[model samples]
Structure formats: structure tokens, C-alpha cells
Target: MKKTKLALALTSAVFASSAMATNGTNMIGIGAQSMAMGGTGVAAYFGAENLLANPALIGKSQGTELIFGGTIFAPDVSSEHNLGEPASPGEPVGKDSSDANLFVVPSAAFNSRINENMVYGIGMFGTSGMGVDYQDNGQMFRAQSALQILRFAPALAFHNETAGIGFSPIIQYGALDIHYDGSETQYGTFGLEDAGHGMAQGLGFGYSIGGYYDAAPGLTLAASYTSGIEMEYKGQLSSASQPFAEFGMIPEAFDDKLEQPAEMKVGASFDMGSLTFTADARKIMWSEAKGYKDFGWQDQDVFSIGAKYSTKSYWLAAGYNTGDNPIKEQDGTTTEGATINFFNNTFFPATTESHITVGGGMAISKKATIEGAFVYAPEVKTRVGVSGIGDDYPIAGAASGDYSETKHSQTAATMMIRYNFD
Candidate 1:
């Protein structure tokens, strides 16, 4: 019933798209309203913005609702590599690529019911996408920092007592600016300090679709998919000391283009009187995504499950997920970077890991509910750079094309607010 603008942009999602659910499921893993029940809203989605999670679940909405939230990411991305043998002194010593700092995100959404079985909505949010800052004096790592995508999407859903489903015609707007720090010591150009800031490119026009089924009263099944988004940009390539500035001399250089592929998800849920169980499987089509139109984005897949319990006063829940490397590496060197990076995270020797999540919500008053959640991912050991790049800066552990094998973990806290009309 109200005019909307902010939510239209939310369609782009928080990280890349909620389809990944790794970065912030607090918003969509449970949708906004369902989050009030703790973070398990797969089979049961209420409101329009949440439709981005499972359109069919929006069938649970009544009247109109507006939702908005954001996530603050504190990534501890640091690691170490072997200088040679286990007996060698300081073999796996400290490295420069640790923690790129912290990032805070802001987002919003809106929705309304068309009837008991139908609902329509729009949203703006982020997904499980990763961004790294290698600008710390080139340390020889990739100085690649990415852009944030602002989305605009419209969706419609249908629900019945027996089953429900929703579809959203989406248009994601993406803008990423990359800066690479390269062989500053190799070329004489290093005389003029500068990190190459590739001009900003626009990646737009992507879509998503999701659905759910109550196969039975206490059982629900769900799945969703998002299309790939492509970005093309042109700008001067150079790091401090005008290292890459030489390429800029061409003058006729075209914008660098990168493609971000689509993603898919599948989940299931069951309700038993006072407690409910939910689980999900997700896929990221990073394979189609290549940087500099050459390097490729690995295909990533994740699986997660959660349980919820409710009492007369509040509710609680928890979950877990597993991840693999997207960087398809063969020899010690990586084929993904424009010039050749020895320590790129995409293909570096990284370890697989699983995380733990727990959270709960309480009734604030007759018209509102407040919720909070916490997740502590397990420590993952992996390398974090391209082979040649690290050695160029003569960075630690980069010379022999060895990955900086180290530990990494991530966690987040969330709060949700809900109110009903007087």
C-alpha cells in the first residue's frame, strides 16, 4: 500500500546473492519475519523481500510488510607458507596478506499480499561473495579490491494450503573497481609510485527464481537459482611507482571485463510440534566468472542444516556449512591473473572446512519480536596469493611458487526488529 524505492535496489543482495547464504543468512536464511523464530525460514517465508529466498513461502504474508538490514564483515585473511623443508627455520613464518580490514554493509526490502495465496515484493541485499584488499604496498599480492552491486528486482508468488512457489524477474546492477600491485621492482617504471586502479565497469541484467512445497503439513522442500552477471571495464593498469602505467601508455586500451556466474540452492524442512528441522545445499557457478577475460572463477558448493525449538516466550536455532577452493590450480603457478600471480586464493592450496552457528529470538511486546545470532566458523588452513605476484614483490614464501598455508575463520552477530500496526 506504500510507495517504494529502497527495496527495489535490495534485489542485488548483500554479498553477491543470498543464494550462497555463507556471509549473512540472518536476513534470508530465515527471511526477516522467520528470523524472529531464530534463523530457520526456508520452508516458511513471510513478506516480499524474503521472497528472494523462496518466493513460494511469501504466500504466508498478510497485508503489507517492509524489511531492511545489513551485515558488517570482519574477515581475518592471513596465512604463511613453507620456505623449504619442515626442519628449515621460520619456514611457515608470518605473511603480509592477513586480514584485509573490516567492511560494513547496509540494505533494505518491501512486500505485500495480493490475497491469501499470492504475494509480491522487492529487495536489496548481499550474498556470500568475497573481496580482498592487496594494496598494502603491493607486498607482491594482487591489489584487487572489488565493487558493490546495487540491485533492482520485482517478484510474484503463489501459495495454497497444499503447496506454494514464487518467481522474481530480477535485474542486478554491479560495479567493481580493481587495483593490482605487480612487479614494481622488475620494470624501471617502478620509479613512479602508483597502484593500478582499473576503471569502474558496469555488470547488469541478471535474474533469479525460487520455490517451495509443503509436500505434507509438517514437511517442506525448497530451492532457488540466480543468473550470472557480467562486468566490463576499461582503465589505466598500474600499481605504485607506475608499475602498470606502462600498459596505460597504449592509450587505446579497452575496459577490462569480468563475468560473475549464477548460483543454485536446494533445501528441506520438517516441523514436529514444538521443534523444527531445516537443511540446505547451495552451488556457486564461479567457473563462468573469469577476470581480465582470462583467469577463471572456481565453482563453489556449500551445504548447511539447522534446527529450531520454540516455547511460549522465545525460540532458538543453529546450523553448519562446508566449502572448497574455486581457484583451479595445476602447477605451483596460477593461470588466473592477467600477468601471473603465485599466491591467488582462488587456486592456492587451501583446506576445506565447516562452521558452527547458534542464535535465538524473544518476544519484545504484543507487536514486536527481537532476535540475535552468532556463528564461529572452524579454522581453515590455505594459501592466499598468486605464485609469480608474490615472488615479484619478493614477498615472503612467494619465490618458489609455494602457497602461504595458514588459518582463517569468520563470525557475525545480528539483531532483528518487527512491529505490527496499532
Candidate 2:
């Protein structure tokens, strides 16, 4: 019993420490080196961290290696709306910032050469998530939510002089919680009350495949694909709570399953003396995913470019990444559409669209190196229901009004230490 309790506690803590969504519910990159280069690792070799990006790159390693790293993520998110009439006179319905702003995402990886033509690796990473805390904002609904995900990947790669291929089987763990205040008599003949489902957890499995070819002495091309991971957080979306049962607002078909979207990436790298340049194009299939599709999310295309200058003992890197926000304004003409829009803005606002990254690494010795990176995503603002819909959208359980706006931005810093054992 004690051992089981301890395992549960550790699992909870690990899930709580996961990060907010950056690129369509996924992190821009896995490690400091990849992040500093705008997450462009499909064709560039970056040691053990490559397990998540392009496992084939691990085959480029000359020896065994271990890496430990963490990211400090901070997101600034706020929401404002007059959609619902005040429950009481002068209840202060204005802009409110989310308190779920800071988190630490940790990662570790180990890679070793099995033979002249084979390499193997394993990695554990806090991959993606999004959440908000509006409970302290004094808003009528006091909406709050949290979604977190972590992944463990074990991979194998085969490589020869100028080509490499790899595969990774992934195990994923996820947690979700949602809460909101509702009103009685808001729906014609039904009563809606506040609801909270502490936290729902689940596990899923997936896979990734990648390959790289050295086309010439100084150029390389690569591509990778990650399959979607399907998870079911029981009692999260289809709970027997007041908002779901009493009011019958959410559709029964919308169940408790939320699938992580699949991703495809293609990239190229050119090396010139001591300088290297890389570019990557990626597609996130959110529109085809189960849960996000139900929430009206669209597919996203992301582009990234990076440059690095290296010396005998140190290296400097910089890059830029951009993507269209997957979530867009929904049709407010209907109560069902308006309700979906309301939840999208209030609970899961993953709206940041651009990122600037800078980083560097220094060699401490022949076997040890330290690296760090910083990422900044400019603020993005979105507004829904600009035109008045009605006074009562009971499906949303709040007063319907002219519009609601959400502003989101983020910053993250990562640090890592690597050791090579030859």
C-alpha cells in the first residue's frame, strides 16, 4: 500500500510540472540546442536530445552520452468580456490574468552506440499542455482548467556512411481538470450550478519514424513523422457534474477522449566552415484530431530557420519560428457554437504565434558541456462574438454579450548539461 501511494504521488507531481502549449499544444523543441535552433533537428545532429526530434541523428554519435535539462516556462494570459450580465450590481467584470503562469519542465536522455551500424536511446520529457486559473479574478464563472502531458520514448537507429533511419515507440501520460461556476434558472427550465472534477489521468501509446541522408559533403536532408496519441481522461469532459448533466449543455458524443495531433516535418542543413544554417517546415494536424476537432481547432503549418557559429570551445545560436494559431473565432449566431467559443477562449487559449530564440553552449572539459537557451513569443490577442448575440446563451451558462477577448504570450529559458563517455 505504501509503495502504491508513493508511486501515485510521484506521478501526480510529474504531471503537475508539465508545460503550457507553445506550438499547437506542442513544445517548439525538446532541448536547449534544438530550441535555440528554432526546433529544427530533422537534419542537424544534436546528440541525445535527438530522440524526440529525429532519432536517426542519434546514430551520428561517436560514443555514449547522457543529458539532463529543464525549462522554466512563463506564460502571460488574460481574458476580458461583457458577454454575460453581472450576477450582482458592480461585480467588476473586466480583464483578468490567469494565475497558472509558471512551471518547470524537466527532461533526460541517454544514448549509446550498440555497434558500428546501430545506436539506441531513451528519453523522458514533459512534452506539451495548456491551462488557466481564473478563480481569483472575481469573474462570475470563475473558470479554471489544467491539462498536462509527459512522454517516454525508446528508440533504435541504423546508420551507414551517408544515411540513417530510426524509429521510436512512445508511451504517454496525461492529466486534465476543469471547473467553472454556473447559474440556476439560466437555462429556461433547468438549473445549472458550479462544477469541478478534481483531476482525470490516462495513458496512451504512439510512434515516430525518421530518416536522414547526407546528399553532399556539407549538406543534409531529413524528414520525420510522429503518430497521434489517443488518451481518455475519464470523468473529465463527460462527468456527471451539473454543467454536463443538469443543464445538458455539452454534447454526449464529445466524450472524454482527447487525442494529440500527428506531426510531420521536413528539413535541410548546410554547413559552411564554422557556420551552419538549417530550415524546417512542419505540419500539425489538429483539424483531424478527435478532441481538438470537436473544439473547432484548425490545422497549423509552422516554419523555422536557424544559424549557428561554432568554435573549438563554444558555440552561439539563434533562430525564429512562426505558426498560425489553431483556434479561431467560432460562429456566435448559434448557442452551440457560441458555447464552444466561450470555452475555447476561457479554458484553453493556445494563441501565441511567433517565437524568437537565442542560445549558446560552452565546453567545460573534454567530456562535459553546458548549454542554455531563451525563447520569447510575442503577445497575440483574439476576440469572439463582436456582435451582440443575445442576453441569454444558456448553453454557456453566462450572460451573452458583444464580445470576449483573450491575450496570450510566453517566455521560456532552458539549461542543460551533457556528458560524453567514450
Candidate 3:
């Protein structure tokens, strides 16, 4: 029972804040400085936080340092649908906001100079996930789902006056839970009950490699690549529960694995006296991923730009980031296509595309610094199920005009404290 409760807590946290993430299911940045700077850290140095962005930057650390932080993420999400007719009379066709709205993500890192030319560090961060809860409202088939991912990375870097390179071996833990009440829909009376089979958990391994070069005085360029991690959650996708078994919606032979997509990034930072500018561009190969590709997710290209001004005691930063939504509406010409489209929008609405960020840092003492950042993402709307439903489909009142629309927006605040040791 304790394990069940823990699973439920993890599941609820991920689902509640899923849409608050900016780039697909990923947070725009890891540390308060990075978050404030529009997630552009590839070519920039921001103390120990560099462990997650470009480990090579650790070589630039002044001395042993420890940084800890958390983000309060809040998402505003709502769904409205008129899918032909309700299974029971008097069900309303209107929009309703999800009660799940807030979550906190934590991060910490420790880095030290091993020698004159080498550095080592370890970092733990909440990396990626997606989910939503519409259970109480029941507007979109009472769907609820959550995916949580965490990464533990240990890194090593070697550098000289002009260039540096680093590598980190990554261990990732993931949890997934999917539930819905299809019984009240025009579709067949079937759904994956909440906690019916418990939450599915797995671990996977990957690696990140990066290098940076000081092209000129006050100018740096860097690039990095992260490998994909494949994980399988036993019994989660292929459970043989009663309604799921009877409906035969998911074939028993289906694979239960979902692979995190690989990422490639390149960035540059220019420092001019008291001001600095940074820019980055990255690509996420979702089309090549396993579960995501099967569900019609496309590749995403993300771009970020930021600027910072610094004085002896304080620094202020601002940034902008944009990415195209990876999940696109499918041409539901076949029953199978329509079903896949319905599931994609209803359960995994990773549709946020833009973010604006601002932040500042203050030196409270000779060895202690505090940083804070705020991020906002404008609302984005998407609709699905408009394509004609074939006659062969088993739903009772589903019509060609039946469709569901979702609106998602987000706001988050991050705070971090950094302590330096002589």
C-alpha cells in the first residue's frame, strides 16, 4: 500500500504540470540562470548548472561549488468536446479546467576542479514528461495520464586555455500511468481504470558529449549531442485487465517500450564588457522515436536567444524561446488513424510552443549567491476528431463533425542558491 501511494503521488505530480513545460515535454532550462536566459546554455557558463547543458563548462569553474534549486510550475489547461452525443443524457458540451495545476521540480549539482586542466561533477535533475487530468470534469472521456523522468549524471571534462570537451554518462528513471473513463462516451464502455494495474516504472541509460572553443576574446562556441534512452514498462501498455482485454483496443503483442528521442544542439555566446548575448538552436528527432513516432509525433526544431547585463553585485537577464508543436492533427481516413488521433490529443497534449523569461541574481555574501527566474508561455489551442468516423467504428454516436479542442498555457518560477568553497 505504501508503494501504491508513492506511485500515485509521482503520477499525480507529473500529470498536473505536464503542459506547463515549454519545449515539447521538456523544460526550457535546468537552472534559474538558464531558465531566465531562455534555455540557452550550450555556449554560456553558469557555474555548476553547466553539468546538464554543456559539461565542458565545468572546466571554467573557479573552485568547488554547490548549487540547489526548484521550480514551481503551474499550468492552465482546459478541454471542450462535442463528440456526437454522451452515453448518458444531460452531459454538457463545454469547457472545463483541470483541477491539477501546480507542481515543484527540484535540481542539485556539485562540481569541483580535479586538477589544473580537468574537472568532475555530478548532477540530479528532473528532465522530461507529459500528462493531463480530466477525470472529474469528464469532458474529454475522463482521460488522465502521467509520465515522469529523472536523470542522474556524472561528468568529466578536460580543458586548456582555448578549448574544452566533456562527457557524461546518464542514468534515467521513468514512470508512466494512463487512465480514462470511456464508459461515459459514445465509444464502447471501456477504459483503463486509475491505478488499475499500478504505475509502471523502468530505468534506462544514455550519454551526452559536448565541446566548446574560445574562438576569440570574449566569444565562445559550443555543441552537444545526447543519445536516446529506451525504456519498457511491463504490464502498463499490455495489461490484461477486464475491460481492456474485452475491448481489444491494444493488442496483447504490442511492445511496451517508449524511447526518449535524441537531441542535437549548437550555440554561441558573445561577451562585450558588461553585457553578454547568447543564441542556440536544437533539433529533437521525435519522428525517429519509438512510441512517439507511432502516435504521429513529428520532429521539433527549437531556437532561443538571450541577453544579460552584469554589475559587480548583481546581474539581470532576459530571453525568448520558440518551437513548433510536434503533435499535429492526423488525417483520420481510417478507424485506426482516428483512434490514434483521439488518444494523442486527449491524453498527451504537448502543444506549448513559445516562452518568455526574465531573471536576476544577487550576491548576498562573499561566498553565497541567490538567483530567481520567471517564465511564461502563451496559450495554444488544438482540435482533433473532426475527420469522418468510418461506419466500421464501434462508437455509438460519434459523427464526422465530432471533435475535441484543448487550450494550454503555463507559468513557472525558479529559485536557486549557490555556495562556493575556498
Candidate 4:
């Protein structure tokens, strides 16, 4: 029973917040334009997305605006495990993993001038989480796992020609699911009788603040901060463990809180002739987040640069984004006499480091416009010990203290339609 509980705890430790971008589960940018420009918007014009990117910029909004959009995210992810010496000779020495899938994320926003000095708007978007399906692969950790968070925010802004400020209160809802076949006992004797899986729904609250200033005639500076939200999920678990046993192994009440980390961003935009150039720096405080910190995940730094040129009825944009990996690679030997590194974050691999983006906008008429963007992140691979976040690989049906490696890559395309009012 103790062994069963331990396994359950391991499974519970797999909480990853939102989507996994270079910013560690957060998207590189908030809107189609932002995504196209390497996620930069702090000081640039991005319509209603200012609610999520930088509320203060909304103070500079003109007329009335509405936008709706979605991103088709396709990710390729895989893993591999190395057995130092097969427990049974003639058995396979190393194994490759096939799992993880594609996803679609949606967004919508609207903004209106409340008066000469104020603007109001609301937006809904997601850094939609990721999942893995390793059901067919035997003995691999995590038979299946998936998580995602969606946010809706309403914003108010006050601004003048020289400066502006804005605020947005955020409401968030999310779902989580995890499953692991327990029949293999290389780690413990708990098998199908303990076939473990947990499913739950949760809600949370947060807020964001932003400021923008026209530093000079043609230059603008902007800054924003988003507070973290504390979330507690209530649901059911398949494991007949402590929390699950209290309710007779049915859909009992299992509770856990995953703290979303705060974010800070600052940037500047320059208007030169028909072109606007922008640069932004962002930080994600993963160390302060609940599940991430416990897993030894580190904070991430993101730097972006982009440029856009406007014509009478069309615009073209491109940008680049890069960041550090949050999950640290593990090295050294495990207690079971196996050497490993890099695979430490297999369960929650949110480790894409850079992106290339390109996009454009076309005016369909005096009142409507269409914008589209494409983003690509090259493949990133990491190798680590199979023990998973630890030095001892006690997994059943495999060699003790084996090695595990994972690779992650993605491509995304997004489109948004905006309507304007005089």
C-alpha cells in the first residue's frame, strides 16, 4: 500500500501550467499580430490584444474594434529509453517512445472607446496545454496525461497623448487528466489492480497591469505585469490510494493546487517612415510556481525583435523569439548503477527555446481586415535517466536505472479577422 501511495504521489507531481511555449507553458505572444512579430506588443499597436499583452496600450486605441481568431498548433514529440543491460539477455537494449499530439487554440476580443480618455474591452484566449498518449508503448512512464488553461479578461484604460495606464481582471478555467498503467512492477508490485488515472476541473482568478508612454515624437515605451493565479482542482482518481480510498475508489474528491507563475515584460516601439520596429524582453517566474519549482524547473528569459511595414491597404511583419529551457538536465549516476542526463523533464517537457514567425494583414474594406501568421519552432531533444526526476529507476518491465530521452518540436498557424468602427 505504501508503494502504491508513492506511485500516486509521483503521478500527482505532474502538474504543468497552460501551454508549453518558450515562456514555459505560456504562448510566445497574445494575438495574431503579436505572434507574427515574435510576440512583441508592449509598445506596439495590437488592437484588443492589449488586454492580455499590455492593457496600458489600450489607452491609445482608436474608434471601436472587434477581433476573433484561432491557432492550429501541431507538435511532434517522442522519447527513447536505454537499458544498460537487459534484465533478460536477447531482449531489446533500447526503446523509442511515440506519443504527444496536435491541438487547436482559439481567441476572441473586443474594444470600444468609452470616451476621449477611457477605453473598455474584453478578451478570451488560451496558451492551451499539451498532452501525451503512450498507451501502446509498454513500461514507459505516464500512459497518458494532458492539461490546459483558458482565460477571459475585461480591461479598462485611461490615457492621453503623452502617457496611458490600464488594468484587467482575469478569470480562468481549466481541466486536467492523467493515466498510467500500473501492471508493470519493476518499480513496485502495484499492477492493473491499481490502474491509475485522475480527471478534474478547476477555476482561478488573476489580474494584469500595464503602462505606455510616448517617450518622444516617434518612440513609445511600454511595460506590463501579470499576477499569478492559485488554482485548486477537484475531481476523481482511479488509484485506490489514500485520497482515492477515502471515497471507495469511485469518483472521490481529490484536490491539488497548481500555482500559475507571474510574468513581467517591457519593450519599446519605434515608428520610422512606413515601418514600425519593436523589441521586447519578458521573464517568467517558474521558480515561484508550485508544481514547476518542485520539479527543479528554472525561470525562463525571452527576448524578441520584430519589424512591420505598412502600405495603403496591406501590411507585412516578421519577428524572432528565443528563451532558455526551464527544465534543467540531470547528470551523474543513479543508485541502481546507471548513468543518465537530460530526461529529467520528460513528464512535463515545456522546453522549446526559439521561434521564427512571419505574417501579414490585408484590408478587406473600410470596416474589416484579415490578419494571418505562421510560427515554427525547431526540434529540441533532451536525454536523462529513466528513474524520472530521480536517480532510481524502479519501473517494472524494464531494466533498473535506465536512461530516457525526449524530443519536442512544433509549427503553428493563426488567423484573425478584425472589424473597425468610425
Per-model CA lDDT versus the true structure: 0.50, 0.76, 0.76, 0.71
Candidate 1 TM-score, C-alpha based: 0.74
Candidate 1, 155-211: lDDT as tens digits: 888877867777877666655544443344332233333445554656467777777
Q: What's the number of clashes in each of the models?
A: 46, 2, 0, 13
lDDT of 2 by residue, 2-96 (tens): 11111111122112211453787799988988899987888988899989888888999999999999998998887776655655664524567
Instruction: Kindly give the stretch of ten consecutive residues in candidate 1 with the minimal lDDT sum.
Output: 3-12
**Over the stretch 98-167, how does candidate 4's per-residue lDDT look in tens digits?**
4555677889999999899999999999855757666775555445767778999999999987999999
Pick the winner on TM-score between candidates 1 and 4. 4
Scanning candidate 3 in windows of ten residues, the lowest lDDT window is 1-10
Among all candidates shown, the one with the greatest TM-score: 3
lDDT of 3 by residue, 158-213 (tens): 99999999999999999987665545445434343342356889999999999999
